[model samples]
Target: MGKTAPPSIVVVGSGLAGFGVLRELRRLSPDAKLTMVTLENGHFYSKPALSTALAKGNTSETLVTSSAEKMIAQLKLDARIGREAESIDRAGKALCTTGGPIPYDRLILAMGAAAYRPAIEGDAAHRAISVNQLDHYAYFREQLPDQARVLIMGSGLVGTEFANDLITNHYQVVVVDILTLPLAQLVPPAVGESVRDALASEGVEWHLDRKVVAINYVGDRAGYVATLDDGSNIEADLVLSAVGLRPNVALAQEAGIDIGIGIKVNQYGQTSDPDVYAIGDCAEYQHGISAYVTPIMAAARGIAQSALGTPTEIRFPPLAVQVKTTLLPVNLLPPARNCVGEWHSVESDVDGDKHLFIDDRGFVRGYVLTRQKTEQRVEMDTKVGELA
Candidate 1:
């Protein structure tokens, strides 16, 4: 008797998550009929590098590490670029894309996430830019002048990193956030204050506990006036929105798959339907969506195995996020959501600061390190165990 043929697997999206899963799948089952559909040009680049690209003098084209041709040939994939997966026909086991319907025995959704832009009442609101992809970065660079004043909304990781990068490039940066301090959700108050102060010392203005109520074109000024919640106004040559990201779950939800903050998936990356799966930013496991690269890479392997008929449970260890703010470098492992804990500064020396979140049982649940202390990231990771 002849050997049984491998199942056909269709993966949606071409971001790191999608590509990661494809790479793993090929490693596990080389002969599996694999297809990749994406809305972009299918060029592979490090998404995290986008935040620091300006300071590193990297253009959109230079940022691409691999072309679609290379990825397709290398992985032996039926690749479709500049196309979108419109919907999924669950019963037919097919993906309805702009190109055509592609049948698959197993489907993986790695659609990633989109930038969340706040709705502000004003004509200039449409002018605000958010760089979630290579093309968006290209447009942002094109609009920026040699010496520009940039107003950034949101003081989170993306916004803070861009602020630092812009400052390095000699642009005046002003950051406004509804939170009282930068990285309020990830870092302790002291660490956040230190970051805010360091950035301010480098000529970056901070507007905490405020929001941009409106943005208006300044008459004959070639800029916009951002009206704040406090009724003050900020004038800038450009406005950049780096609020956050929301997972792309519309397709899954429309397909009648279970949806939470993201498309809900089990440890094996299996969705409500065993044949269908999800990973990366689009997937919400037992805890929630792990949008960072580390977690995504870990999930990719498990997802690949499950798609290959070998079920594997994904386990994400405590992951540390390195904030790109070079002014006061930060390495943080955020405490679990709703964990009963309190953060205490364990050490503060010339090397920098370290804060640990200790649960009521006295176990270290999380840690934040600054400056030279960030080198302890690996040690801290081992101590923190699995993150929910």
Candidate 2:
């Protein structure tokens, strides 16, 4: 009798996570039946590059490294681009996508995440944009005028980076956040103040500790007047909502897969169903939702091994995320959720800043570096203990 063919693997995204799993899977099993489905055109590009592209004089088209055809040929997999996965039919072992139903012996959900848009009353609220994908970035670029005034909601990593990039690119930028300081969730007060001051020096305006109550259209102008909770208003040509991202887990949830902050997956990225798995921003493991690239890559490896029958458990190291703010470069290894620790700034002679999050037992749980101090990322990464 002839040998039985391996079961087909259907991957439900073409983002970094999806490609990461595909690469690792191919490396392990040469003839694995693989297929990739995505709502995008399936062009591979660095998503982090989107925020900083304008400052470097790069356009959306310049960011794409490979098209669907190129990736399909290079990876030797069936490609389904510009198609949405409507739902997962667990019983039928198939994905119901816009194009058609795709049967799979194994399934991987790498559906990344969606930009969060907060509820605010006003006529122009629907006009507020959030650039989470290449197409969205392209639209944002098209909407921007020369020397435009931009109002950004949320002062987190994406908001701050966009502020720096816009300011550097000759745009008038204003950032508003409910938090007291920029990157309030990630960095210490001192570091956040440093970032705020640095960006302020570069012509970026900050309106912290307030939320947008309304976004009204300016009188006969293609602009908006954002009314804040403090009864203040800011006039701008465009508004960007960078509040954050929520994992795309509706499909998994509908399929009866467990979900926490994201789709709950085991150490090997397996969901409630052993044959189905998840990775990247859409997945939540033991620690939490590891939305960053380093952790996603780490999980992808284990998921690939598990899908290929090796069943390798994911062990994530201290993954430090680099914030692409040119004004005040930052590298941070955030502490675990609800971790009982306090940040203490390390005295530095270099023209930069460093801080460590030490727990009750005096163990270094997390670390942050800014400007020249970011050079210590490698050393600090090696010294920090495993993340959860």
Candidate 3:
């Protein structure tokens, strides 16, 4: 008898999810032939810092922690960088790329999400810069002119963060949104209002409950004219589109894989086809799912276990959504689900304020604490642990 042939796995989209899968799978089977395909140059870095770059006085070139060559050497796997995965040949177990078709025993779609650019009448505004990826940010940085007038669309977390950073960088920044308040859908009205107020105090102008109807390119290099829904207009040197994101699922959908908000997957990160899996921003979870970092880590752990032949079962635990705004002087953590609680706030000179969501059972499900009160984190954790 002879030894069986080793399985080959192909992972598409080399973002956090793809990198996670590769790293986990390697631990599971060191001899497993793994290949990663990416649309960009397949560099690796922490994306969380993208929001605070300008404020930190960091350039896009300096932000990139590692390049494709470094990642390839570190991961020690076959990598196809700077090439797009056109589609998948499931019947043949291959990924069609710009370079060529590569065979795989298992496929992982981690291409991540694309910025949702809405249909608005505009020449250059609609085609404005977006900071979703390092590449896009790099391009925006390179093309930025001296003392640019920046207009940003959308007032969600990313939108506000970028606005704050741009203001810190001495750019004339204006944020426009159709919502009555910023971070409207994420946090409660009161909390969201506070965030908007804080950002406004930092010199970020807001056009709440308004929309950009059209955009016009000004004289040769005179910037842009942004038309508003109220028949008003503003001129700017550049515009940033920070609307939202839609997962990259065309590849999986083309391969006849399940598609929901994103590529459908289970706790094990397994798709409809067991041999295929998806993760990260591109993964569509089911039943009161939270698309945050904690669940993604759990998905990676469970998927790796299965890939290693242990076939472990893992369920995502209730994790708080922590909003990192260093200027906020508080760590804003969202209230957990199934928590019928009262939201109360306690203020201290040491800690700006401690906001707690206490359940009927006298347990703290979640909390938002200011940096001044971060020392009280132990007490909050104890309360949450009781509920757990």
Best by lDDT: 1
RMSD of 1: 1.3
Better of 2 and 3 by TM-score: 2
- Model 1 Cα lDDT, one tens digit per residue, 10-52: 9998999999999999999878999999998899999999999
Query: In angstroms, how far off is 203's CA in candidate 1?
Result: 0.2
lDDT of each: 0.92, 0.91, 0.76
lDDT (tens digit, per residue) of candidate 2 on 69-150 = 8888888998988889999999999999999999998999999999988999999999999998899999999999899999
Per-model TM-score, in order, reads 0.98, 0.97, 0.89
Question: Candidate 3 residues 1-388, lDDT tens each?
Answer: 9997777888887767778778888877878888888877788766667878877777877787887788777778898877889988878888899999999877877878889888789777556777888888888888778778889999887887787778767788888999988777555565666667776787778898999889889875768888889998988888898888888888889888889888888766788888788878888876434456666677777876776566666556555554555555445456655558777765645446667777788766677675567666666666675666
How many steric overlaps are in each model, in order? Answer: 0, 0, 3
Candidate number of the best TM-score = 1
Backbone steric clashes in candidate 1, count: 0
Residue pairs with backbone overlap in model 3: 330-370, 351-372, 351-373
Clash number for candidate 3:
3
